[model samples]
Structures are given as structure tokens and as C-alpha cells.
Target: MSNEHITTGQAPKPVGLYPHARRVGNLLFLSGVGPRVAGSGPNDSAVPGLVLDHNGNFKEFDFEAQVHSVFQNVKAILEASGSKWENLVDVTVFLVNMKRDFHTFNRIYAAYFKDNQPCRTTVEVNALPTPIAIELKCIAVIE
Candidate 1:
């Protein structure tokens, strides 16, 4: 099977030397995707409903917005990879603070995945490489 690296202008540009996703055969594996808007840099304050100071301190933060934005990003990548939201087979979520965000994330997640319930795992971490609060690593099958 041939492997392919995928990039899309519809989703946030990757922070480093990595494509948004990789496709092997019929499987599409997405890199960790965050909530920063498309065409925004890693350190920019373009994250949906998030703001930071010059010292990178949080000036404003909205977990709900981040959650929605991340999902949008994941969807964009999936479509760009010849797949769709319903094609997702598995998803792993990363949150900066599980206690503070899990409830909200779960609420929003349920709405998005109501019809296409893919296997999902969520975990807390100290931080992500960007200012966003959530990220998603997804796997989908392209039929």
C-alpha cells in the first residue's frame, strides 16, 4: 500500500514539520489537531475565544469555543482526506485540564457524535504545544 501525507488550507496549519494527516491504504490518521483558526500561527491569539497577554498569560479563555473549534478542525481534516465525520473509527482527545473541561467537552462532543458514535478516549495533559485548550487525534476509514 502507498502512504500519503495530507495537508489542507481549510484546517489550521500544522505547527511543525508535519502534515495534517497520513493515509495508508484506506486508513486516514490525523495528527494532533488544535483549535487555532486556519491561517493562524501557533503563538497567535487567533484561537477561538482565547486571548493571551504579551507574557503569554491568559487574558481570556473559553473552553466551549475551543471544544467547538477543535471539532471543526477535525472535520475539516477528515473531509480533506477523502473521509467525512461519520467515517471516523476512533478518536483520542487531549485536554489541558480534565476536571475543568471534561463536562463541557462531553456535552459538546455528544452533540457532534450523536449519529456517528466512534470509539473515543479523552485524557488530560499539562499542556499542548499551542495556546488552545483541546486537541484531537483521529483515525478514519476512507471508502
Candidate 2:
């Protein structure tokens, strides 16, 4: 089957050389979607709840705010790719500070995924490409 790269002006411009998602057959593979804004944010949500200095170091951290914002960004990507949140089959979440924020993140995540549950794995990493603390990579069936 042929695969097509997906790009949407509605989502944040990628921080690197990658399309927002890719489609093959009836499945859509989303890249790690962050809570980044397409344009400048006075709240600086490009990394949700993260206030990054010019050097890409965190100036503040609000785990709760970041959690919900990340979901909103992912929702936008699913819509842009003609997929739905309920169609998501798999999700891999990256967290920079699992010990400090996992409980709250999990709570927020459960609320967002209350009705539609998808298999998920959350892992802690040292960092992400951007200053953000969380990101989600998912696979969804485009129905």
C-alpha cells in the first residue's frame, strides 16, 4: 500500500523535519504531537505549561496545564488527518518527569479518554526535542 505524508496548517509547524502524520491504508500514524502553537503564544504554550527561556531551559512548570493542552493538540492532529480520538488504537506517551508528575498526568489523561480507551504506554525520558515535558505518538484507524 502507498503511504502519504500528512501536514496540516492547523497544527503547530514541526520543530524538525517530519510531517505531522502519515497515512497508509486505513491507518494513520501520528508523529509525537506536542502542545505547540502554530504561531507565537503569549502564554507560551508552544510547550504547554512550559515557559522556556531563549536557551530552551524551563523557567516554569505547570504539569496540570500541560496535560490538558497536550490532549487538545493531539485532537487537532487527529482531526486534520481525518481520524477521531475514538479511533485511536495505540498511544505512546513520553514524560520527562514521571515521578513528579505521573499521578496528575494520569488523572488528566483518564478524563480525556473516559469513553474511548486506547492501549497506551507512558515512558520517562531525559528530554524531548523541544523544551516540552510531554508528547504523544499515536496510531488511529481512519474510518
Instruction: List TM-score per model, in order.
Output: 0.96, 0.88
- The numbered model that scores best in TM-score is 1
- Let me know the TM-score candidate 2 reaches against the reference structure: 0.88
lDDT of 1 by residue, 1-90 (tens): 969999999988898999999999999999999999976766567899888888889999999999888889999999988999999999
Model 2: residues >4 Å from true position, as ranges?
Answer: 39-45, 53-57
lDDT per prediction?
0.91, 0.82
What are the per-residue Cα lDDT tens digits for candidate 2 across 1-143?
A: 85989887777777778888999999999988877765433234466566867876678978887777778777888898889889999999999999998898888888888999999999999988776778889999998
Clashing pairs in 2: none
